[model samples]
Target chain A: MPYRPFDGQNCSIAGALAIIGERWSLLVMREVLLGRRRFQEIKRNTGIASNILADRLQTLVDHGVLERRRYSDQPEAYEYVPTRRGLDVNPVLIALMQWGDRHLAANGPPRVPVHTVCGHDAEPRLVCSHCSQPIKAEELRVRPGPGANEAQRAEPLLPAD
Target chain B: MPYRPFDGQNCSIAGALAIIGERWSLLVMREVLLGRRRFQEIKRNTGIASNILADRLQTLVDHGVLERRRYSDQPEAYEYVPTRRGLDVNPVLIALMQWGDRHLAANGPPRVPVHTVCGHDAEPRLVCSHCSQPIKAEELRVRPGPGANEAQRAEPLLPAD
Candidate 1:
């Protein structure tokens, strides 16, 4: 099937998904962010096939999320490094890790993120940027913003609670 | 191609991806969480073809992330609802939305999540649950936990900074 695009949606989640929503995309990012920059290393870590890995890496590079830099001239070797936009995907991966640990891990998390500055296990939680208060899943609602389409704007806004 | 499984990885993110990693899966969840529960509603809102939507919904239901309940008997209609496991995916979606808004959306966010308790836009940020301090992506590192396999445990640990 040809790639499905979420064009004209005006939704940020959709926009983000357009770039990194493929099944192997975020996993590739995880490998790179974990310091497996070489193709063989990323492939070994992710278990993605060579062709698919090549395609995803190209897509990430095309979208400006990753940059491929030459590491060896004679061997023509390259390493994939995260660009600023690529680094921005860290929160998304962290959130997924937390959810997976809480809901799916039977033996406990396979890995845990640690806050280097504080030298403590970083159990990341979402807090409201405006009030700096913790935000729970059920304690939030949504409203149309500047980019909402006509139909979305007409939909009734309701409190999640 | 047949569905690819991330088996024997022993990673929570990989575990979660094995369940909800398909391109349309999370978008389907977004529709349901936004209160579009009925089949026609979710279909119209997401623009997902019937077969693919059916597959994604069934996958979610099988994984215990969503529950299908009868809402009508005469026509034998059903509605998909988020279970506790499903609701836990909110943080993942929220993190993606924040990333999209910051980096993808050009006209501003199409919708903004509001903290019902504070009655203001949530603008969620990640903070360390241990130290209760905001966490930067660069200021974190990962170490093997209780579930790590021998290979993963053998990998070198490096500070994210």
Candidate 2:
């Protein structure tokens, strides 16, 4: 499929989606983040065709989310490792997993995130960085920021409902 | 493109992606979550084709993420409203937005999320719900949960790196 870039949107979500929004792209990142860094391992876990996986990995590398490093000298083998930008995607992955566990998982979540700090199963929650209060969808509002273009600024900023 | 369902993965992330993993689906959700409920408004903002927008909205409604309600009587105008499931997608959207703001936004965040509770520009962070410590990608681990099948359980759970 041809990639569609959200060039004019001027929204950060759209900007991020332009990079990692594809279905397979995020799944590939899931594998890398889970420590399955080799080509075959990610391919095995995702069941993605080799060509497609290669393409996704290249795009991720081009975007600086993952980096390739030689792991085996004799075989010329390389491993894909997450950069800081890639590791930052953890929250998005966790958010999606929690959503699935709540709505789609009939039996239960097949995988659970463990917070090594407190030694317990981690239920990650989105909280305000300044106030430390849990963020609710209705309580959040949007406004034009420094990066907002003229078109974006003209749009209604407050929650309409 | 044909939608490829990640059957047999038995992973919540994959399950979630099977629904909203499509590139346009999440963008559509971003629009709805931002209070752009009407068809024309969404189309205008996302620049998505009308047919594709219609298809995505129908899929979201079918999945219980959104509902159609009559907003006008004479012209039979209707609006899309987020259900609980839809509202739950806010975190994912916020996470994506923050990622873009950090990495892609050249100027700054095009839009800022305001925490209504504290009346400050909200920088949402994912923290352990139990300990309230901020989550770091390197400090987290995954394990097979109650819903894990034998295959998932057999895969190495620890972070290899």
Candidate 3:
């Protein structure tokens, strides 16, 4: 019954949605994140139409999520690479995978993430930035910040910290 | 020129494409992430069609990214909350914002994130699980485990930790 495109008013999440929240956009990102930098490789994997893929690539390039680099001068070939802005999208893709694996998998995780550094399988644990303590939803509090709206008077949205 | 979605062939990202990689879904997630729990608020904020909002919410609930909770018994009022699975999707949303704030914003970040534990602004930093060192794309090494398909070769996707 709801449309949840973004959370807070005028927040980064909202701003992001305004640009790349369309269908096929993140699919393109998934390919770049997965190392499919070449146009042909990404096209082969996703099965997206050529025209649509071209548009999505241009959009991502426009959004700074991908950069188009000339791969071959003979054919004027190009490959799309994630910039810092693009590479940062990995966590989001990982988070989405965690959701899909949990709810959608027929077997177990259709895919698994290996924390290359952990020396073992790794699960991301959210920790408090200041205290360095592991944080959970109940353990955290939310309050109106500099961006709070005039109508948002409901007990700071979360319990006081 | 290429239809990149099918080429890289990592299932988690692929599965993410089957669900949320479509248009309007992430923006919907944005609203949910921002704390709008009702159908009306989501639709209002996102300007999505009532039918489309209904469909997206159903898809999310069906996928377990969000759960429908009864707010009242009489009318069977419900609100959506992230299961542990749903909250896990935050990183993707964050990544999208990082892209948006950097490329889309004319000024600076339209919104900011705060580390609830320390009571100040904090950004999510990816760290190497092995050394607990903050990780950048260049520092990590990943080899596919049992999950690697024919599509995923030894080639590292994105920059390694």
Best-fitting candidate, measured by DockQ? 2
**TM-score for each prediction?**
0.95, 0.95, 0.76
User: lDDT at A63 for candidate 3?
Assistant: 70
Each candidate's DockQ score against the native complex?
A: 0.72, 0.77, 0.33
Estimate how well candidate 1 is docked, as a DockQ score. Answer: 0.72
Model 2, A112-154: lDDT tens per residue? Answer: 9989889788888778878989888667778889888898788
Report the C-alpha lDDT of model 2 over B1-161, residue by residue, as the tens digit: 24565877888898888887777889998888888889998898898899998998998899999999998999888899989889888888888998999998899888998888898988887788778899886777788899999988887477755
lDDT of 3 by residue, B1-82 (tens): 1233433444666676566665566777766666777888878877778998898899888877788889788977788887
Candidate 2's displacement at residue B89, Å, is 0.7
Native contacts kept, each candidate: 0.78, 0.85, 0.32
Chain B, TM-score, each prediction?
A: 0.92, 0.93, 0.80
Q: Which stretches in model 2 have alpha-carbon errors above 4 Å?
A: none
Candidate 3, A115: how far from true, in Å? 6.7
Error of 2 at A7 (Å): 1.0
Query: RMSD in angstroms, all models?
Result: 1.7, 1.6, 5.1
Per-residue lDDT of A27-57 in model 3, one digit per residue for the tens?
7776776667788887877777888789889
Better of 2 and 3 by DockQ: 2
* lDDT for each residue of candidate 1 in B1-161, tens digit (9 for 90 to 100): 13656878888888888887676888887887787888888888778889988888998999898999998999999999999888888788887888888888778888889887888887888899898989887776788888877987897576242
Task: State model 3's lDDT.
Answer: 0.63
